[model samples]
Target chain A: AQSVTQPDIHITVSEGASLELRCNYSYGATPYLFWYVQSPGQGLQLLLKYFSGDTLVQGIKGFEAEFKRSQSSFNLRKPSVHWSDAAEYFCAVGAGPTGKLIFGQGTTLQVKP
Target chain B: IAGITQAPTSQILAAGRRMTLRCTQDMRHNAMYWYRQDLGLGLRLIHYSNTAGTTGKGEVPDGYSVSRANTDDFPLTLASAVPSQTSVYFCASSVGSSGANVLTFGAGSRLTVL
Candidate 1:
């Protein structure tokens, strides 16, 4: 079985400040990782995905994640966050092409002004 | 055209009553899935269909049943609604092989069992 863990349940960052959200997964094979953002009262939107390739993958809204194979971590980062970035973020992992996503509990990001 | 549409966007049902959450996708995807989102639990898969005629159970499938009669429709049924079943349900579909495709989701159906 595969599982994902987001260490922080909640995080607060001021506008224009850098941010990083930690994610770790347990999978036997090379994992396919994804980052999804869910705004209030809306369905989740795919931020980025890492199948196989470069260790650093860039996503929308200046978001990017580094896949560290040795550490089993794929952490999302942004140089600076905006007020609109306040939303719940989730890190998901799946094995092979089964495409069945196992999601983390989730991390609520609060962008303080 | 709606990429995916769910009927009765929100509903409140009495416990033990039967309810079906209708899901339709125009994308003609090969796989469809049903997931429930509860507070702090993220989204948990309840059932999935790899094709029109085959269905498989997911992580939480005990209280849910699903049918895929064709490529465009996959409806989830609750045999007996329970308070525990009161959560927002999302229907999603993906193209090609089950494990390799990106899922497109419907807006969602909010169910309340009282």
Candidate 2:
């Protein structure tokens, strides 16, 4: 079974500071990676996804993630996070055509002014 | 565009009562899925339907039942609701089986079993 791990439970950062949310996965074969963001009382929105090709992938809202096969990591990063960017972030890995996605515990991002 | 619509955005059901969470998608996607989200745990798949007629069990399917009569609808039901079933449920859909099958999610249906 494929699984995702998000080490950080909560993250607090200043309004203009750079941010990174760590994610690790355990899969036997090439994994399909993705990052999603959810605001309070809302469904998740896809931030980005990595299928193949380049290791680094850019997504909406100035977010990016890099897939490292060697370390089995796909970490989400932002150059400067805004107050509006504060939300819960999730890392997920897809499993074939079943359309099943294994997600991480999630990280609550707090943007401080 | 109404990507996905889930009825009774929020609900409160008594224990042992029957409840059905409705999910409808306008995308006419080939695959639809149901997932429950808890406080500590990420979204866990409850059930999934590859197309209109084929349904499959997900990670947590013991307490839930689903039916896919057509392409647009995938309803999840609980014959006897329990306290442990209280959680926010989300409905998602995708085009088909692929490497980068991105899923579009519904607003979510929050159910509380009292």
Candidate 3:
């Protein structure tokens, strides 16, 4: 079974500072990877997804992730983060063409002023 | 129009009681999914339907049942609610079975089993 791992339990970054959230996955074949964000009491919103193509995938809210096959990692990055970007972020893994996603525990982001 | 609406946005039920969490989508999507979110555990799929009348078990299907009578509705039911079942439930839908299928999620249904 495919699984995702998010090493960070919590992250705190100052406003306008660059940020990176780490994610790793275990899959045999080409895996479908995704990043989702959830606000308090709300469902998850997709940040981005990577299937099979360019290693780097861009997403909304100025977020992006790069898929590294060698390291089995798909780390999310942003040049600058705003206070509004503070939320619980999750990394998901799915089998190719199945449309089924399995998510990691999650990493909560805190924006410091 | 409500993109996806879940009935009884929040519910508090006693242990051993039976409850159903309703989900409906108006986008005419071909696939619908049910997932539960718990603190420290991101999101786990409870059930999924490829289309109307076809349902599949996800990672955690214990104590949960689902039915898909039409293209728009995929409701999840629990025969006996337990404290372990207390969590926020989310309903999502996607277009096809492609690798890049992006899911559109509902606001969520919060359930607290006392």
Among the numbered candidates, top TM-score falls to 2
Which portion of correct inter-chain contacts appears in model 3?
0.69
Chain A of model 2, TM-score against the native?
A: 0.98
Q: Tens digits of per-residue lDDT for model 3 on A1-113?
A: 68889999999999999999999999998888999999987888999999889999999999999999999999999999999999999998875665778899999999999
Q: In candidate 1, residue B23 scores what lDDT?
A: 97
Q: Between candidates 1 and 3, which one is better according to TM-score?
A: 3
Which ranges in model 2 have alpha carbons more than 4 Å from their true place?
Answer: none
Docking class of 3: medium
Q: Interface RMSD for every prediction, one decimal?
A: 1.9, 1.3, 1.5
CAPRI class assigned to model 2? medium
Model 2 pairs whose backbones collide = none
Candidate No. with top DockQ: 2
Q: What's the lDDT for candidate 3? A: 0.91
Residue A10 accuracy (lDDT) in model 3: 97
DockQ of 3: 0.70
DockQ of the two-chain complex in candidate 1? 0.57
Q: Could you estimate the TM-score for every candidate?
A: 0.95, 0.98, 0.96
Candidates ranked, most accurate by TM-score first: 2, 3, 1
Model 2, A1-105: lDDT tens per residue? 789999999999999999999999999889999999999988999999998999999999999999999999999999999999999999999987687799999
